[model samples]
Target chain A: MAKQQVISPLPGTFYRKSAPDQPSYKEEGDQVAVGETIGLVEVMKSFHEIKSDFAGTVTKFLIDNEDAVMAGQALVEIDG
Target chain B: MAINVISPGLATSVQDLGRPGYYHLGIPISGGMDRYALRAANMLAGNDEAAAVLEAVFMGPELAFTQDATVAVTGADLPPKLDGEARESWTSFAVKAGQVLSFDYLKGGARAYIAVSGGIDVPLALGSRSTYTLGALGGLDGRNLLAGDVLPLGAGTAAAEGRSVPAKLRRLPGAQAELRAMPGLYWHRITEASGRRFFEDTWKVALEADRIGYRFRDGRPLEFVERTPPFGAGSDPSNIVDSCYPYGSIQVPGGTEPIVLHRDAVSGGGYFMVGTVISADMDFIGQLQPHTPTKFVSVDMAAALAARHDRQAMLNEIRAMLA
Candidate 1:
């Protein structure tokens, strides 16, 4: 199967979980669904959900939690 | 009603220049963050310069028009799409009835202003249509537009399409920004060496940048001069007796991060303000994106007033170009 990637739509801080105390939205090898929020991009204090466009299994994350991200940057790789 | 909200983007709110004179009552002057962009948009759409417009941050709203209208998007480089076809920013365009208007991903800047022909007709609260979401005072129900909400439009003549604001007239932020600030308020609280460090350091906009204020990081922490705490003031060196925080005040708490108060900030606070970003540069701060490199350039009163005059002159030039 080919792999796909999810990209950030805005430039800001990227978080894998909803909050500091929450569990990761997805783990490696976890199944993913289209429109499922994998993480959040916080820009100018507003949080925007970064949803996966391709449904597949979580292969790897390109960025770590609480990482600063730029728009159009690839975030995670998924195996479809 | 003339427009229907399909998707309210991230934070779409109705705003004008702002409602001043009520700060004494704890009401903030909530308005569009980029006042110059808002004015230019209104001018391009043939509305009064201070007419209410929709301010979308980060993302653009998906709106459906119930009637034909002239529209213009300004500020950010977010491209407007009419019925899935792309349109230019800073230029007036026409939207037919039942057409859905969306946007491409943001290219640069932060917030975008959408101005319609007749302006948004949300009932005025305190002589302005701006929304103060914290106090729930004005704008459409004192909140952002939500999906499926229908907004009424005031009656006005629409301008011809293709009216574009000149490139030079657009007030977009560059790759790096320098904000001219005048040291005042509690500048004495910090040691002179710390003041020099503050101006010399290069800071980046923190994630806490918003309507209320913008926090900066990566700069060296400030060192405060030793002093005994006054009554009613907290023991922290960065604390003072509760004081009115002027707009554009640069407040630093714990002698660490500096927060520049913007349009929707609280009227007063206990934090000691080290300085104030001059009035002319406040609009520039609104267009800055998170993580942008920035520096503080210290200036005196004479230089601050000169910059303000230059800003006003630029506004006049824009007004003429759109006229």
Candidate 2:
């Protein structure tokens, strides 16, 4: 098995949930498919989905929920 | 030839200088946040200076060309990629029919303007090709570019490849930006101490920043002068009788977060504006990233005019060089 990381495409605040009241898109150990949204990066009031490219089990989250992220920053680790 | 949208990048929209003269009708002047960059890209692509270009924010749209064309990317260092190979920003390049154009990660700044030869051929609305998405008025159906959409191009001359703008002529923000502002109108509504602190304290660009306005945070709350609320105004100290909001006007809602209205801001609002960021500094605000430290430098009317003049001179220099 190999582990890969999902990277944020833009810089801004990262959110695990779509909204404050919603459940997180993914959690550790959750199975994810290619193109599955794992989180969102909000830039200048707009939220863009961070989709995983590898189908795998979520191994670890590299960035914390609601933390600031830079473009190309690794966000989550997945084991396939 | 047309551009086929492969993947519409985040907030990619058609924009020009903007649609003015209709703000009184509640129509905002929606266009590129950084006007200079838009014009520069258009000129480099051999289009009219005010021709519409695609404005991509943070990320660049994946586009496939239906014909060979010359193109230029300006503003922000979101390096343009022609079929996976990197191309220079602020320089004109050629893209062949069936070639895909994309962008690498944003290296600096915010929005990038992509100018293709002949410009975007979306029919003009309200005398401009700029998109006013809020009003659904101008641009291609008055919205952002979407996947699978085909954008037509106007007739244009072929601009020479490798036409590069000198590095010195390019505009990029420094470590910190000082936005010069002219305090007036409702400046007296806040306590003198609050007014002083507004100029003294450093503020961070808030996540709430967007096309409508830019919000700043981490600054001290403004203390307003005790006064009775005016008719139709809310009870909050930051509220005032509804008034016209000028572009670049700074309004502190609840006397806490200061929001500077930008190109697409509402025509009227109830908030009291403490001051307006001078025209010369408004472009700098557009390039500021979230969490960037900024200071509002207070300037008098004469200084503001002088800065405006200097900006015009700089534009003239660019025009002459390109001409």
Candidate 3:
């Protein structure tokens, strides 16, 4: 089985869940399908929904919630 | 036919719709300043809407068409002539081989677009032919046009004769333009007085305007209500957080003059974005010349979406007519 990773396309603050105090969309060891919403990235006041490009179980989150990410920075690792 | 550039205008470059899906790499989507005029020119020339065309600023080049082809000029109302004969804009005309084409000083607006039947045959960079002057990529070596440069036209057949611009395609009247904007990332940091001034007062385009950005002369310096630390781990006060800026984002450094980012603007900036001009109004903003009076109007997301849908409907009707 191959492992996959989701990456942030833009530099901004990342939110693990949709809003504050909400459960994260995915947790470590959780299954996700391609195009599934993984998280949201807030850049310059615009909130962009981050989607998983590959189907797999969550392995680990690269960055914590509210952490700033750079372009092409990895966000999540997933194992198939 | 080949045309020789005698004078390459103030800031001429080849542009198209723009390069998308690469903002993660910090590559700004550089394209035509007036996308509406560019697309209109292409449509009249019977070319794809995204085809590359010459974006001439202030003035245009003096050239001789080496072959017979059809061309259309749009956007700014620059006085254009062929072989010294005055010509009308927003209409296609036959350019005979050896006919010299020249444009006089712009009487109104800042930029004008010249479209040939087959479009400009410029090398593609990053899946687009738009010139990102800052990155020095795309368009005749990624710089402003210079004297003695000869641009090549793409290979394509021409449409029938007598295609003129539709009345609806003409730009709205009035030298005063009101730009609609959506609240940006740092919109809340500005004071209520500054926000009111931003929407109520008219700002004049300063002489410092260029492809990168347009500086406007706001009546008074803008002051932010809260001083949010710029993005970055550094303790330096000048450090700003790196962020992706969409087209039409207006950034104010030190809470002063408003600078509207244009096609050739940078991907990210270290300043506060008070607001972003709606996408549909970007073309109108591009045509603004120096000293032009303009105002910013705030609109909700729903209005912006509706405006976009309306534009799409119009475009679809035009396509249907051509089909």
For B25-83, candidate 2 gives per-residue lDDT tens digits of 89888888999899899888888899999989878999999998999999988999999
TM-score of 2: 0.95
For residues B40-148, write the lDDT of model 1, one tens digit per residue.
Answer: 9999999999999999887799999999999999998889999999999999999889999999888888889999999999999998999999888798999988998
Model 1 regions lying over 4 Å from their true place: A1-3, A19-23, A44-46
Better of 2 and 3 by lDDT: 2
Q: Evaluate all candidate structures by whole-model CA lDDT and list the values in order.
A: 0.91, 0.90, 0.78
Best by lDDT: 1
Scored by DockQ, the top model is 2
Look at candidate 3 and tell me the lDDT of residue A29. 89
lDDT for each residue of candidate 3 in B7-54, tens digit (9 for 90 to 100): 786568889998886866778778888888888778877889899999
Q: How well does model 3 score by local distance difference test? A: 0.78
lDDT, candidate 2, at B175: 64
- Candidate 1 — number of clashing residue pairs? 0
